[model samples]
Target: MEVLSIVLGGGKGTRLFPLTQSRAKPAVPFGGRFRLVDIPISNCINADFRQIYILTQFNSASLHLHLSQTYVFDSFTRGFVEILAAEQTFEHSGWYEGTADAVRKNFIHFRTQNPKYYIILSGDQLYRMDLKELLSKHRDSGAAITIATTAVSREDASQLGILKANKNNEITEFMEKPGPVKDISDFKIPAELRQDKNGKGDEYLGSMGIYVFNAEAMESCLANELTDFGKEIIPAAINKLKVNAYLFDGYWEDIGTIRSFYEANLDLTTLRPKFDFYDEDAPIYTHMRNLPPSKMNFSNMNQSIAAEGCIITNASITNSIVGVRTIIESGSSLNGVVCMGADYYESEIQKQQNAEARVPNIGIGRGAIVKGAIIDKNACIGEGCRIGVDAIPRVDGNYGHYYIVDGIIVIPKNAVLYPGAVI
Candidate 1:
C-alpha cells in the first residue's frame, strides 16, 4: 500500500537545553556521527516508504540543511524527503500548537498525494523499526488507526501515554502522563503479548509516539480542530474508530531529556549496546564527510566509539563517545562522557574568543579531566579544566557555567570552559 511518513521535528526541547539551543532537537548530533533525526528518516527509507515530509518549527535551519545534504534520491525515482516548516496562510496564521495541529496544517500537502496510509513518527527518539510491520498489522486488523506500543515499567508510566489492549490488541483505554503515584494496574498488557508468555505481564503498555492512520480516518479526524494526538486525537479516536495496538519488542529510547540523551550515547560505548550502529544491513545514513582515518598517538581507550577525523594524543578514554573532527590533547582523560566534536576545523572566529563571546572550535585541551559529562559541539575545554567532577549527585537545575540534569554536567553548544575551570 502507498504510505507517506510525517516526522515531527520536536519543539523547543527545553529539556535538552544547550544542545537544542542552536538547532532543532532532531538536528542535535547523536551517537557521535548521526543526528537524532536520522533514526526515523532512515527507518522510512529502509522500509521502502520513501515519500516523507518533516514538520518543523523552532531552530529548523540546521535540520533542513542536514536533510538537503543527506537525503537525495535518484533522478528517476518519484520519492523524496522534504521539509514542511510551519507557515501562515489564509486559513491559519499561527504556529503549530500541538502534534495533531501540525498534521492538520499539512493536510493540503498530503491530500494531493492521496496516500493509502499515513505514518506518524517522532524525530528525537532512538530506535530501529521497520514500518512495513506496522503497516501489515494495520492492514490485517482492518483498524482505522494503529498505534505502536512497548511495555513500560510502572516507574516509567509517568513519562509516557499508557494504554490497555484486549486479547485482539484493540486499544480500550489510554492515559497520558498518569503521574507515578497513580495506579494503572488495570491497564497492563495481555499475557500473550509478553515476551516471557507466562511472565508478570503487569507492565503498562506505553505509546512510542508512532502511529499509522488510514487515509480516510486521518482526513476525517483532521476535519476537527484537535490540537494533540495523545491528549486529544488518539484518545478520542479510540471511542469512535477501530484503533489497534502494535507492540514493539526492541530497544526504543526517548531522548527528550539530557539524562536520557547522555545515557543513550554512553550506551553506544558499552560491550553490547541496546542500539547498535554497527548493523550493516539496516545502516543509519548521514552526511558522508569522507574524512581521513582517525589518528592516535599512544592513546589508551576501552569500549569507546571514536568517529573519523579525530586526533588523539596520549589521552586516556573509557566508555565514551568521541564525535567527528575531535582533537584531544595529551594528558587529558575522559570517562563515561560524550564529546560532540566540532563540525569543522579551527577557524579565525575561534582565535578571537577573548574579543567576542565564542566557544572554542577544538574539542579538548591538555591536562583536562571530563567524566560523566556531555560537551556539545563547538566547545573548547581549556587546559587544567575539570568537568563533571563537581556535579551534584542528583540535581536538575542550571548552574552558571554548566547545567546539571540527573547529576550529569552539560556544557551548552558553542560554550567555553576556561583553564582550571571546574563544574
Candidate 2:
C-alpha cells in the first residue's frame, strides 16, 4: 500500500515553554542526542513509509535544519522527508488553527504523492510500532479510519480522548478529555478486548493521537472547517464514517509538558527504560555527528547516559543524561539532571575572552551542585552554582536566568548562571 505519513508539529507548545521558546516543539532536543521530531520520522522509516511530510507553523527554522541534516534519502528510492511550513496562500491566508487544519493546508502538497492511505502522527510522542500492522488492520476491517488506542488509567483518561469499542473493534463512542466530574465508566474497553478475563480493572481505551485514514475519508473529513483531530475531526468521523480501533499495548508517552518531558528523559537513565533506543532490530535514527567518544577523568558516574564529545573531570553524576559536547568541571555534582550540552566547543581564545568578560564558559563550572534540573543546550553554569539543590519552594515562572516549571529548574538555551549563583 502506498502510504503517506503526516506528522503534526504542534504550535507554540506553551506547556513546554522555555524549551519551545526558541524552536518548534518537535525541534526541541530530547534524550540527549535526538529531537522530538526524530521519533515519528524514525518510526516511519523503520516501517518503510518514507514519503513523509512534517507540518508546522511556529518556530520551524531549527526543525527544518535538523530534518535537512539528518534525513537524506538515497537516489535509488522515492523516499523523502519534507517539511511544509504554514504559508499564506491566496485561498487561505491564516495560520494552521489545529491538527486537522495543518494537514488540510498541506493537502495540495500531499496529493502529489497520491497515497491511498495517510498515517497521521504527532511529532512529540515517543513510541515505536510497526505501522504496517495498523495499515493491515485498517485494510482487513475495511474501515474508513483506524485510530491507534492504548490502555490508560482513569487519571490519565481525563487528559486524553477516550473511546469505547465493540467486540468487532468498531468505535461506538468518543469523548475528548472528559474531566474529573464527567462519569465515563461506560467508556471503558469492552470486556472481550480485555486480557484479564474478570475485567476487574478500570482501563479506558485512550486515543494515541495516531491515526490511519483512507485518502478519501481524510479528504472528506477535512472538507469542513473543523480544526483539531481530537476535538473535532475524530469525534465527528466516528458518527458518520466506519471508524475502528487498533489496540496497541506499547510504551507510548506524549511528551507534551515539562513534567512529562523531564520524567521521560530521566527514565532513559534507568536500567531498563520503558522506551529503549538500543533496539538494533528497529533502531531510532538521528543526525550522524561522528564526534569523538566521551572522555572522563576520575568522574564517579552511576545510572547516567553520556553522548559523544563530553569531557568530565573528577565530577559526580547520578541518574542524568549528558548531551553531546558537554563539559563537567572538577568538583561539580549532578543528580536527576538532563543537561543538553553545548553546540560547539569553545576555543582557548574564546575561553580567554569569556574570562575577560567575567562570564563562565559554555558548560558546568567547578563546584557546581545541580540537581533535578534541565540545562538546555549551550548553557553555562558558573562556579559555586547551586540549582534545584536548596530547600526552598519555587513557583513556576520564568526568572531572568532560569525558570521553574513543574517544580523543576529549567535553564533555557544560551542562558548563563553567574559565579556563586544559587537557585
**Candidate 2 lDDT, 256-307, residue by residue in tens:** 8999999999999999898999999889999999899999999999999999
List TM-score per model, in order: 0.94, 0.97
Cα-based lDDT at residue 400, candidate 2: 88
- Residue-level lDDT of model 1, residues 1-423, one tens digit each, is 389999998788888887888899999999888999999999999899999999999999999999999999998767899999999999989999999999999898988898999999999999999889889989999999999998777777788999988888899998888988987777866555656222434377889999999999998888898899989899999999999999898888999888899999999988889898888988899999899889999999999989999999999999999999999999999999998888898766556764366343367988999998898887889888987766446477777767877777888877778778877
Model 2 CA deviation exceeding 4 Å by range: 195-202
- Candidate with top TM-score is 2
Residue 379, candidate 2: C-alpha displacement in angstroms? 0.3
Worst lDDT run of 10 residues, candidate 2, spans: 193-202
Clashing pairs in 1: none
Where does the lowest 10-residue lDDT sum fall in candidate 1? Answer: 193-202
